[model samples]
Each structure stands twice: as C-alpha cells, then as structure tokens.
Target: MPGFSPLELEALALSLRVALWSVLFSLPVGLFIAWLLARHEFFGKGALNAVVHLPLVLPPVVVGYLLLVLLGREGPLGQALYRLFGVSLPFTWQGAALAAAVMAFPLMVRAMRLSLENVDRRLEAAARTLGARPFDVFVTVTLPLTAPGILVGALLGFARSLGEFGATITFAANIPGETRTLPLALFSMTQTPGGETQALRLAALSVLLSLAALAVSEYTARRLRARIDG
Candidate 1:
C-alpha cells in the first residue's frame, strides 16, 4: 500500500466496481440464455448462439464501436432511454461496466451451457411427473445441480471484466475514478513520462488480482464437485 499511489488504488477500486456490477447484471441473463441453448431448439438458434459468442471472435474495439453505435446518446436505444427515462450511459462507469459485460458474457454462457448440458434430464422429467412446475423444477433441481458452473461463470466474467480495456476505453473514455479501470490506468501510466514505477505497480496488482480470481474459481469448483459427488 505504501508504494501504491492513490491513482492506482482508485483505478483498482473502479475496476472491481465495474466488474462486480457487470457480473451481477449479466448472471441471470447468462443462465437463461445458456439454458435455452442447452435445452431447447428454436428458429435462429444458431444465429442467436453466434451472436452471443461474437465478442469472443470479434476485436474488442469492434465490440466497443458497436456498443457506441447502439447505446450512444443519438443511438436508437440510447435516444429512447433518454427521451423516456432521462438516462445516458456513454463515458460513464455504467458504460464501462456494460462494455465489460459484453466482453465477458460469452465465457459465462459457455460455462453454464456445458453444465446444463451435463445435467440429467431424467431428474427433470421425474420432477415434472411429481407435479413440479417447470420453474420449480429448474429452481429446485437444475439450479442446485449446476451451481458450480454458475459460480465458475460468474467468477470468470468478473475476472474478464476487471481486465477489459479496448471496449471500456472506447465506450467510456477513461475518466479517472469514473470509467478508468486498472487496464486503462496502466495504459495511461505508460503514456506518461517517468511513470514506469507506478505502471509496474499496477501491472503487478493486475496479475495478482487475476491469479486470486482464478484460484478462488478453481477451489470453489473442486469443492462443488466433491459435494455433488458425495
């Protein structure tokens, strides 16, 4: 803490904030979409799946640009929200979180879909025969069984959000203590003269944070597996 500058601390805090919000907002939607992909066949299913995973294949900058086009003040959704609800997202922390969420969503969905696919359909059918509603079966059976995957997905999304750079910087414009997360902060430091020390500190912090997230995810996954097996 002694060597870590206030700016670095702010950036780290903002990154966590953005990542937390991104994961929280995206989790339910991720689970629902994953379930749909794993359990149902519908028109445009392939297209929907492709779109959900598009961010992984597309450049981050392109994703950011698309977000800007769809969410900028003059953009359709942005304009409607502003006119009806007086809300704006561009260049704000919320926009940063949205960008991070878009980038992290595919990983979250993939993890959950795999877990859902592995769930025993017979159990669900038994629940249905026992008079459980679809929602009840999902809540009481499917969710509990797939909890590990959901946890892993959330952690993975959080980690990805923490390190998001191109999309966040593009959509949120790197405002200090607002939209400037750890990666953007490091980028800014590198551009400054004689800022290598602070940059190095931030770089190390990023690595530590990522490692911690991964460690927690692995530990949780193992515990969940053991519990399920037992």
Candidate 2:
C-alpha cells in the first residue's frame, strides 16, 4: 500500500472534525425547526417547509455558490461577522462544515419531525393537567420520547456530512491539511497519478464509517424504543 503523508492524515482528521462540528451545530436548530413544523400551524409554514427541503433538490454546487455569496468576506453577514467577531468563513474548514450542515439539514429535520409526530399528545396533556408548564412537559416527556429519533437524525447527518464533497470543496477549495475532508482527499487522489489504490482505500474507509454509523443509529433507535415501551 502506498503510504500517506502527515498532510494526508491531517486532512482525514480535519474531515472528521468538519463532520462532527456540522452535526453539533445543526442538531439544535434541526430539532427546533422539526418541532415547529410538527406541532405548529402558522402563516408561511408551507414556505418554511419548502425552504427546509430546498437543499435536497438544489444542486450541491448551487448550494456552495450561494454560501460563498452569503458568507464570503465581503458579503453582508460575513463582513459583519468579521468586524464584530473576528470570524471569517470563506475558503475554510468551517465553511466546509457549514455547507455540509446545510445540505444535511433536511434529513435531520425530517427524522426529528417524524419522531415528534409519533409522540403521544395525551401524555403532554396529562402533565399540563398536573400543573406542569409547557416547557417542562416538553423537556421531560416529549424530548425523552423523541430521543431515539434525534439520535438517528444526528447519525444520519454525520454520515451525510462525512460524504459531502461537491459543496464542501466548492466552498472550502479543498486545501490539503486545512479544508480537505475524506471525500475531498479521495477526489484529490483520483486526480493524481498512480493514486487509484489510495482512492480505493479512502472509499473503503467511507463505506465502513457509513455502515458503522447506520448500525449505531439502528441500535440506538431499538434501545430507545424498548425503553419507551418498557
């Protein structure tokens, strides 16, 4: 096997970092949005639902380009972030993760929304009758019941983020040891001479990671369901 350099290893680690951060940052937002969509009927709700799923239908490159415009150094939000917080997102690993998060958000929201829909409203009503606050009922009862779905959504999002390539490379420019992720590294290898073996290895790694994530998600869902039923 052709040995990888330190830079290659760094890219691999950075890829994992990007995926992890993306999952972490998006989870809460996904949950909130899922809850809103599942439990509320508000004006523009349909529009919001459509927008949430837009990334699924839009081309990945288009999503990346939009991010570049919205988060670029001179872009309004990006400029404000830079001036106010000394943060710049363009062409960075952080940008790649943001892109991944946006792309995977729909799946997360869908999974969580399904879980929310499955929750028994009667339990919430019972709690409310006992003088429990809305927030308390949500925190203690609704959230606990939806834990399995949340876990599944997170694992699914993580797997999707790990495989993100077109958008991440577009937004982050595939800088080795900085912005390049697993998929980006594999893509780079595919373009290099005599790197087919390395690309194959990276592909295998991606497959293994995906399988492991899926298995964990399934186990978590089963365990959570058993606990809820027990």
Candidate 3:
C-alpha cells in the first residue's frame, strides 16, 4: 500500500464530494424520468427516449461543450442565473458535480426504467382493487419492490461520477481543492513530468473505490430484495 500524500487525499475527498452530490441531486429526477418512460405514452416518446440516452452515446467532451454553451458565464441561461441570483457554476465544484450528473444520468435512468418495467403490473392492479389510491399503491407496493433498482442506479451513478473526467474538466477546469477530483488529478499526474508513480497510485485508488461501490450495491440490493420477498 502506497502512502497517500495530502494532495492525493484531497483528490479522493473531492471525488467523493462530487460523486455523492451528483447522485443525491440526480436520484429523484432519474427516477421520475424512468417512471415516465416505463408508464407513460404520449407524442414524441421515441424522441424523448433517444434524448435521454444521448449522453451515453455522445462523446463526453461534446456533452461538456454543450453544457458550457448552455451554462457558461456568457451563455444565456448562465447569464440570467447570475443576474437573478448571482449563482455561477463555471470552474466550480458544483459545476463538476453537474457535469458528472449529466454523464451518469443515462445509466441511472436506464436501470430504474428497466426495474419499473419489470414490476408486476398485477401487484399494482391488486392494490388498486383493494381500494388503494395510485399514490398509496406507489408508496406501499411499487416503491418497496423497486428499491433494489433505485439502490443499484444510485451506486452506479456514484461510481460513474467518481470516474468522470472530460466533462468535469471542461466545465470546471480542475482547480486544486475545488474541482480537481480523482480522475482529474490522475489526468494531471499523467501529464506532468516525473509523476508516473503518483498516476499509478491514483489509478489503483480509483479501481478500489469502484469495486467497493459495486460490491456494496450488490449486497444492499440483495438485502432489500430479501426484505421485500419476506
């Protein structure tokens, strides 16, 4: 085990911060999108689905550029936000988190959508037959059954956020102790002269974190599934 320098530790902390915030903010929206895809039928459904998944297929840098055009200081929305609330996102940790969230959104939504689609419609129907309202049915029946998927999606999104690089760097510019998350830090190490060892250390750290996240997600999902079954 290599001793982690203070800078390395900072990168790890920043990565965790960005990943957690990204997952936290994206969770409800991802679930809503998933539900809409699974249960709704309207005009432009196909287009909606394509757009929701565009990030997965598009180059991350391209996505980052689009975000910049939409949210940069000189961009229309960004300018309006700054004028209205003085909130700026460019070259900030919040910008990094937003970039990560956008990149991870497709994975989270897809996982949740599949889970929603797989839900036994009969169970929901039975709840309705038993005088349960739609909201009540969702709370008591649909949610518990879908909890595992939610967990999986959250953890997946978190892991993806941890590894986010191109979009974050483009949007947030990788400032030390602010937006320089682990992936960005690793990129820095690789680009700097005489930093190969540090790069390897960061790479190892990333692999460990990703594996741990996956393991926890699987174990927790199984526990939730057991409780639901019993």
Candidate 4:
C-alpha cells in the first residue's frame, strides 16, 4: 500500500477501463467471425481466417504502428473519422484500447470459434423444425451453447489487454493519466532511481489480476458445462 500512489491507482483504473472497453468492443465482432468460420463455406474463407489470426503472429509494435498509420489524425480512416465525428485515437487511452483490442482479437476469435465448432448443428436444425427463424435459432440456441467460449475469450482478451506493452505504448504513448497502463507504468518506474518498489507492487498487482481472470474463466466454463449436462 505504501508504494501505491494515487497516480498509480489511476493508471490501474485506466488500464482496467481500457481492457474492459476493448473486450466489449471486440466481442460482438469476434462472435460474428467465429460463427462464420464454424458454420459457413465461402470463397476466401481460408484467407479470412488467416487474416483474423494475423495479429497473433505479427509483432505487437508493428500492429501498433499499422494502427497509427490507419487511424492516426492524418491517416485516411483517421481523417475520415475526424471529418465526420471529430473522434481520434492516437495519443489517447481509447487509442491504447484499440491497440489492445486488435492485438487480442486473434485469441478472442480462436476461443470463440472453437466454442462455436462445439455447438451441435443438429440442435440448430431442431430449432428450425420447431418454427424458429434463423435469427431466433442463433439467438436462442447457437449463442447459449457457445456462451462458455465467449466468456473464455473475453477473459483472455482482458488479461492480454492488461499486459499489452509495445502496441499500447506505440499507439498511445506512456503518458500518465492518459495511456500509461500497468506495464508502461512499471517500465517507467524502472527508469527512475528509487522507483523499484512501486514497480514491484505494480507487477504483483498484474499477476494477481491475471490469475483472477483465469480462475474466473475456468469456473465459469465448468459451471456452464454442468448446467448444460443437467
């Protein structure tokens, strides 16, 4: 507690906010992509799957830089966004969230896709036979069956976002009260004399948070499976 300053707490809070928002923003997209990969056959399907997983293979810094180039103020998409909505991403916490989201997207998609694949197509057919529309079948059957996977993906994404360093720093910079997440704060502390204590504290906090997320994810998945079996 001695090492936990108000500033440090703020950084922790911001990191949590970014992680939460990133997972929220990416979850729906991940679900859609997962459903497509699990159930559909189309031209370029392989390519799209590869593209969805690209972030997992690419360098985090490279992903961050690409985001900057595409979503920065003068970049084409950035410019269009600014012209239309006056919203910007670079140098802000939201930008850091976006970077985290993009980097964690592959993991989210993979987990969801696996979950979707586990869903029984026969169950979906039964729903259709029972007069359920396509949308109704998906909403009531496919989604519930895949809930465990979605929860796992979201938790994984949150953990990944918390530890994100290169991508977040590159896109948002390590400014206090803005974009300085736990990792960034820890790194910053290492550079200053007598900052080791605070760094250690932040590191411990990061570990605890990650472990908590994993535990929750596992518990949730097991409970879901039990209910389904029941």
Maximum-lDDT candidate = 1
Q: Give the alpha-carbon lDDT of every model.
A: 0.93, 0.89, 0.93, 0.91
The lDDT-based order of candidates, best leading, equals 1, 3, 4, 2
lDDT per residue (tens digit) for residues 148-176 in model 3: 98999999899999999888888889799
Give lDDT: candidate 2, residue 134: 100
RMSD of 3: 1.1
User: Least accurate stretch of 10 residues (summed lDDT) in model 2?
Assistant: 1-10
- Model 2, 44-100: lDDT tens per residue? 999999999999999999999888888889888889999999999878888988999
Candidate 1 Cα deviation (angstroms), residue 104 = 0.5
Q: TM-score for every candidate vs. truth?
A: 0.96, 0.95, 0.97, 0.96
Model 4 scores what on Cα lDDT? 0.91
The per-residue C-alpha lDDT of model 4 at residue 21 equals: 90
Candidate 2 TM-score, true structure as reference:
0.95
Clashes of 1: 0
**Over 4 Å off, model 4:** 1-3
- Give lDDT tens digits, candidate 4, residues 173-221: 9999999999999999999899988888989888887888889889989
